[model samples]
Target: MNSIWVITKRELSSFFDSLTAYILLTVFLGLSGFFTWLYGSDIFFIGQATLQPFFSIAMWTLFFFIPALTMRMLAEEKRSGTIELLLTKSVNDWQVILGKFSACLALIAIALLLTLPYYITLSFIGPVDHGAVWTGYFGMLLMSMAYISIGLFASSITNNQIVAFLLALFVSVFFLIIFDVLAGNFTGSMGQFFNFLSISTHYESISRGVIDSKDLIYFLSISFFGLMLAETSLSKRNIVE
Candidate 1:
């Protein structure tokens, strides 16, 4: 646990010490704010008291932005031959993965927190569904966890940051688009199955201000599965070393 926190703090500090964190936060906030307030689907045009527009924009923005943020977590370490040095510090694979994951999540949480003014402004203009807004944030957090895990796994599999980014984007696209489309085209059990597998499906369910156990389970399960794969990949690298 201490090792994990040490790595987490180090990674988090490194993020702030470099331009990576700033770029990610700026782009994420800029796009999310633009689409939520200035774009065609702006809240004023929607005539709703909900943060649905922002949520919609956020979902798309995260799809691209998150991979960029996570692309170098392990890929760069491996490329620069620093992963071995990292491991030499009494840190196990799972601890390293968890530390990196926590750092990314913390960064994301900070980004999300910066958007609170949106909520505050929305509340002043109209009746905002506080419950829904809370749940929506929860859903986004879950979505981030899932993406971060997948992104970490992508990084673990390659020593090239660009390849890791592309692979993460490729993997995320399946959950973001392919599964959703397949779910729509299927029928009965097939539809149900695909829908169950779709991240958006669970996200929507939670965003409705209703926290379903199944939805929670789905997000956690996907995150866990991805992390386990990453751990396995790192273990293999250790064996090869």
Candidate 2:
């Protein structure tokens, strides 16, 4: 537990020290804010006390942003041979993976929290559906957890940050779009299976204030699977060395 927290703090400090956190926060806030308040299908245009626009834009934004944040988490460590050094310490592969995962999730959570003013402002406009708004935020966090784990897995397999970034994006595309498209093209049990794999399907369900156990299980399963893969990759590399 202490080891995981130590690595988590170390990773978070690196993000801030490198200005990655600042840049990501600025761009995420800027893009989401623009589409939600000033650009197409904005809040004023809808004239409703709802953050659906923000939630909608954030889903796409996070899909791309998370990979960037996680690309260097392990890739750079391996590239610099720092991963071996860290592993020689008291922590094991799972702790290392979980630490980086927690760091990335914490950064994403901070970015989302910064958007709370959108909800606060909406409340002043009219009677806001507080339930839906909070659920949407919850959905975003769940989605981020899934992607961060995927990104970490991608990073773990390579020493190149760009390769990790692209790999993560490629894998995410299946969950984000390809599965959804496949689900549409098929029928019966096959269609149901593809639809069940679609991140959007579950995300939409949760964002609509329908927090089912299945949706919770889906996100948690992805997070666990991806992190396990990352740990496995790290372990194999260690064995090879």
* All candidates: TM-score: 0.97, 0.98
Candidate 1 lDDT score relative to the true structure:
0.91
Candidate 1: how large is its RMSD?
1.0
- lDDT tens digits, residue span 1-241, model 1: 9999998999999999999889889999999999898888799999888898888889888888888878899999989999989998887899999999999999999999999999999999899999999999999999999999999999999999999999999999998889889989999999888888888888887888989999999989889999999999988974786
* Deviating ranges (above 4 Å) for candidate 1: none
Q: Write the per-residue lDDT of candidate 2 for residues 145-180, one digit (tens) a residue.
A: 999999999999999999999999999999999999
* lDDT scores of the candidates, listed in order: 0.91, 0.95
Total clashes in model 2, counting residue pairs 3 or more apart in sequence or in different chains: 0
